[model samples]
Target: MICPRCAASLTGKQRSGRICAHCGKRFALDPAVHGKGMHDIRIRGIAERATDHGRLKITLTQLWYLSRTRNYAWAEQDPQGVPAGIRWLVALPVAVALLLCAVLTDGVLAFVAGAAGCVVLVVASAMRHRPGRPPRSQIIPSEETFRQLMTGAWSTAYGRLPKGVVDDARPVPRPRGASRSRASAPLSRPTAVILCTDRVAALFLTANDIPGRLGAVLLEAAGTEGTAGRSDIVTGALKELAEYRSALPVVVLHDADPLGVLLAPLIRAAQPDRVVVDAGLPVSAARGKQGVVRLARHNRFADAEQLRTVAGLPEADAKWLADGFWSPIAAVPPRLLESIVVRAVERALAAPPPGPRHAHTNGFLTWPQAPQTPHARDTGRPGAGTSKREGTSSA
Candidate 1:
């Protein structure tokens, strides 16, 4: 372990009771008790990278993913310690002695003992041949473990999280149409709406003020429990679309899961005239990569057939997601996720007004295509000379 305050390497002796011997300071986490990869220094480093060395702000949920050392699978073996050779060495003397006694004394009892010893040796060999546990790197620690480290251990030690790490940006939920935080301040008629399938991703963007920078309103995609209420933080989406900006471009960001892939189409159905850009994480990003951290769900919320037919996801990806595995967009480093959002927002901003071709359905990140015909302005598409709208949303 390394002392977070003094940057001094520590051994078990120096880290006794979770205190630094050289600096005489109390620290948050001990790798000895937690996993071998977890500690105060490591946490800080991961936070720094996620923030791009303090250029960006990150949420606790994002940090949780960055802290993982392994990507767990559904079926993993338990480690079987102690080799069969070692077990055989320990029992060989006893077994040979018993067999020798049986031959010398011609005793039935001694022969029975020798048979039992042979059976034990056979069982030990069989145990050795049994499948061994996977390596520790493949075993993912639960989110609860990281939560305790941040909430309990890190808080107790540092009095707060590391710099640039925002745990709960909005601790208390605000009623709809209320502006309580700086992140939720009203904008002047937002021309675009950024719908994040996961509330955590939306919260991250809000906490970091990413939407405000991009001149967009952040909304939690409907269908999840209690998420409808979150849309109230600003004005209702219907009012924003129908009254304020009827042709507002909607940018959808989501995890690489069944529900995520289906969310963009749902949003399009809700507002057919609006331009929709699918900025969600693709299944390919999380499915086959050994290094990607994919979390599993116990229940199957959506099916592969729907993903393939409706969302247009390929067969293999749909099958993987139907098995209830997902990788969160929030898991992408804060800087990268923010940058991608910026790019998607730019695409949204370039989108034209509603017309016959009002939406986009490209693969991973679909952008509204350029107006195909002349006099597109007559059909409601934006003209080349049209100026970009400066928009914002209320809290």
Candidate 2:
């Protein structure tokens, strides 16, 4: 194992103390790292190493003063200067000089000069103590650099590149109580197919009973199966859609990041005629929401491709994505995600057949019911509401 604190290679003996001989720093091995998986540990280690040297240090005097002070708002307010009394003493003479000049000169010209002097003083005072740029270590790692380090560290620790979670080529298990007879079995097409960005999101949704409630099939778009060039599950899903000729909606549930937003578009390319809705975490939902995990800087082949594919997105969104801001679908409150999925499924199920003009409008589509016609609104027969006397007179 490599010492996370020093980045030095460690032998089996050194692993026992979890200490780095080079840096003389001791690290407590987090049980979660080994318990969960090595991938997470690697990511954390990379982030730590990237920032450890870059962290800014404060002197003891500064720390003591900051702790003792009540009025000082470090980083928020400017540092206190010469006492207010001293400032006033200096400003009084300047003010008196300005007043004398104003009285001696044209009032308008004097006023303008006085205003300019005040502006300069304020600007100089404000600029004098402005904070400098934070250390690079304090700044979050860039997506590219973070990914490189994560990948390199993983390779060094595991002797191989990390793989996607859903890379297995095996077929998905059939639902329980499916028909036994192959020929006579009824075709079971889901109302909507839910595509996840990764395996964790898929597993989370599965654990939360999303499939049972929504009757949707969950798929990982960048799963190992897709990356390995043997996407049996995806192929099977596309085949099923073709075979059933079902107008089933495809819902993409992904992270609230650049790559996730593009999942719907990728799925749409496969089924151009089908409706594809982004049920994934949206930017709005991600904001102020807690438990949002960041995407690992390093990406597998599919992930890199996804980033490339979304290049044509609007400048702001593209920049945000490129900067590596992401929140996984699991970060969303499970109940909220479940509710969103339920509503999406219900809407899809209730949607009317597409019209000629709406055939291509299924991309980024919503499920809104068409307005009811006046004839359809009538509850009884055409003449049923008429009075009996009126009916008899008409007869």
TM-score of every candidate? 0.67, 0.39
Off by over 4 Å in 2: 1-189, 224-244, 287-292, 295-314, 353-356, 359-395
Q: Listing every candidate in turn, what is its Cα RMSD in Å to the true structure after a full C-alpha superposition?
A: 15.6, 22.9
- Which candidate has the highest TM-score of all? 1
The models' CA-based lDDT, in order, is 0.65, 0.44
Over the stretch 1-395, how does candidate 1's per-residue lDDT look in tens digits?
67888989999999888899999999988878886568788778778877778766667877877776555434224445567677778768777776777666656787787787787667766664334332121223457788778888898988988877777644623323334453444355675788776777877777667777666888765443233443342234444445445567778788886767876676566677777777888787677644455665533456788888888888988877766566778776566677778988888778775566555543366322321211101112122222221111100
Q: List clashing residue pairs in candidate 1.
A: 176-232, 186-394, 187-392, 187-393, 233-395
The worst-scoring run of ten residues by lDDT in candidate 2 lies at: 386-395
